[model samples]
Target: MYPDIPIRDWTFENVSGGTTGEPVKFRHSGKFFETDQGAKLLFDEWSGRKIGDYQIRLWGSERDIVSGKKDWMNKIYRWMRNEVFLNTFVMSEDVIKKYINVINETKPKMILAYVQSIMEIVKYANLNHIEMYSPRGIMTSAGTLDEQMLEEIQKVFKCPVFNRYGSREMGDMACSCNKNEGLHINTFVSYIEVLDGNYESCNLDEEGQLIVSLLSDYSMPIIRYAIGDRGALSSKTCTCGRGLPMLKCVTGRIIDFFKTMDGRIVYGDYFTHLFYPCTNVKQFQVIQDAIDHILVKLVFFDKDVDNKGFYFEKENEIKKAMGEGTKVDFKIVDDIPVSKSGKRIYTICQI
Candidate 1:
């Protein structure tokens, strides 16, 4: 649609990948930054996050921290925003303790982070009997937040946990309103639709792959972009009264689902329930190798915690859920690897 836009004017680039492992770069004009920031602020204000609020971002990598330290401009910008970055990639006992201490001291107004990173901190707080300062609200992004994890995060943080669904390729697409009902699409910036395998729109409340069309980025127009996520449209209107359409749920990427022995498809969230309140378990991943065999990789907080009892209990639960015919093997590991996209994969189905 953008015929006269100059390629040199595109100032922003977003790198994303599909299951095939090739990286695709999307370009956007500088104007997109302002529009995106405005939409984010508008949605965040509904959750009581406002300007000049203390924002603690549980994000960043080793490279990000190092770069921030080396570049005065980035450091100043972060300081001006009153934002602190806690490196989610570097999680160790001493590092977590320091993070907890800093958070307790700062008492931030907003806690923005990946769902899993915050969940890990919450688990550490519960285990160490450390009391964290209550923030106004916690806004989670970059990954799907399971119901169990949401409940625990709210319980520990004592704040409304807003789930945000977005991909780097499309920027911020949707966020839950204060009503905590469902994620409202940012209609001003993008058009979103749920489509079936045939590329036709799915009926309301029916699950399908999500395809997005970004209206704000004409410099490199994205039309019906398959974002590789699954979700459903809400049949009911949100009580919050926003005219924007609602997404019932943003199930993670299509690869996150597993096939059961009976050929039934089970979502990642279904297996997530197995580790609710996930106090003892530090991290976990479920791999379905075959119709009859499943491998569970886990990392426990305490190396000496009653492994035998824990395994027995979890094995029974897995059997009950997956079926008695399915075999369950528990292997304790130091850590699970993140995906090539730098996001954690919870479920893997080889079959």
Candidate 2:
């Protein structure tokens, strides 16, 4: 829908499909080249995603725009929006259950799950003494999670929940290393520039918007495109040293961080690694409405999870973070809802 490629006269049928020998020429947005590059990378990354030849079929459907129901415009609107959002959000129950079962059976050392449901799994891991992977920053949703929210996500686990960021347009862009707290930009695929308010190069320690030039897409080349994030470049390099780029003070989206009674800051990355061996958990989310009131939303594996020592363990840990006098609460939600876009925000903060 967005690339806006014009269909040939023969493609005017209700449903049309085709094969392209070369990249699509119509809809050459700046990303045409980069999309090409990413396409190759994607092919290599998930070589088995395609087992045989396939023809991409494009069609139009109607939607109830007023009630946000499905209609032709809505059908086109959905795919026109973002290619990745559609894939991430509208997954089948069987697909979700497959991943859930894999997690339960394998009990991996680390897991990187979305916000709304990751915690449900973490809750289960905690009960079984499973040490899930959690980073020190926000357990951001599919896109970007703000700093304060990242802080709160991390507070759920003693270990840090490392922050990772990327988009369908942009491949894997940045991830915080196990050794360092700073996020390292994946410079192999793209170049990054920070622009000040005046649209000039921002000085070190100065906060500015990020613009990216993707080096990988031949199908879609995005040059000097804004990444919709604000951050400060680090003059001092990191000791962990992967040597791509160092970023500090990343404040793109709004994240709320509150001080507990004892003054500990809450972050999202705090929750990532906290759920590993907790096999009975499905997914979860943590909601903080106030400094004293924190709610734990959970979805379980068997409709009923072992609550035996679950409450006492996390209660003490949370008390340590919020302080001795803070009051905590729990909400057992049947569903930790997903957004219209399908991205799940793990930590919701108000304070």
TM-scores for every candidate against the unseen true structure: 0.90, 0.47
**Candidate 2 C-alpha lDDT tens digits along 295-341:** 87766656665685876776777676767776766666656555443
Tell me model 1's lDDT, rounded to 2 decimals: 0.79
Clashing pairs in 1: none
Instruction: Give per-residue lDDT, candidate 1, residue 272.
Output: 73
How good is model 1 by TM-score?
0.90
Task: Give candidates' CA RMSD values in order.
Answer: 2.6, 11.8
Off by over 4 Å in 2: 1-28, 31-93, 97-164, 168-258, 261-264, 275-277, 305-308
Best by the TM-score measure: 1
**Model 2 collision count:** 70
